[model samples]
Target: MKLLPCVYLSAKQDPTSKQNLSAAMKAGAQCHGLWVANYGNQQTNLRPWNRDQIEPANPVPCKVLIHQYAGDIANGLFDFNQINPFLENPELVIKRLILPPA
Candidate 1:
């Protein structure tokens, strides 16, 4: 199955974060394997590290990931606002999603 990567930033760091995460996991997004990027530090943290400390994992299904992404997108919780323009025009976002990665 295809896989996609998505993220959501809490608006006020509230308890809803856990609920949102649980919902994503229940929807089959493999929540345990999240990769958090601390943009302030320019660092990325991956969970479930091995003894050798390597990043080895596969992304969850694209459908599941995209569903979670859309949820956050609708809630305006993403790290970037550049997508706001496309919020009302999902056709553009769908095109971007289908494009090959650079």
Candidate 2:
């Protein structure tokens, strides 16, 4: 099975809800590496690597891992149309899943 990172975009102010996540499971989404992060920059004493390393791992095996790369897009998290551009590569206006390189 192929494993790819998934960007869970929640329309609500908070993270993706349990209801939504449950629905996703019924639809065959197996959530891995699940965690929550509020949008925006914050101060922390821990170095980036150390902090990231401590983030919990997914106990359940899944084809997708939830990722957060909602980089400072203007209409991001609000406009659905903006999502396509945010995910496309140059020289092509396309819709595709962007998985991290192996």
Q: lDDT of model 1 at residue 18?
A: 48
| lDDT tens digits by residue: candidate 2, 8-60 | 43222233355555567667875532322323332322223232432223222
Query: How do the residues 49-85 of candidate 1 rate in per-residue lDDT, one tens digit apiece?
Result: 2212221122222211121111133445444222222
Candidate 2: where is the Cα deviation over 4 Å?
A: 1-3, 6-16, 39-41, 47-102
State TM-scores per candidate. 0.26, 0.30
Q: What RMSD does model 2 have?
A: 10.6
Q: Give the least accurate 10-residue stretch of model 1, judged by summed lDDT.
A: 62-71
lDDT of 1: 0.33
lDDT of 2: 0.33
- Candidate 1: deviation at residue 82, Å? 21
Q: What is the C-alpha RMSD of each candidate to the true structure, in Å?
A: 13.4, 10.6
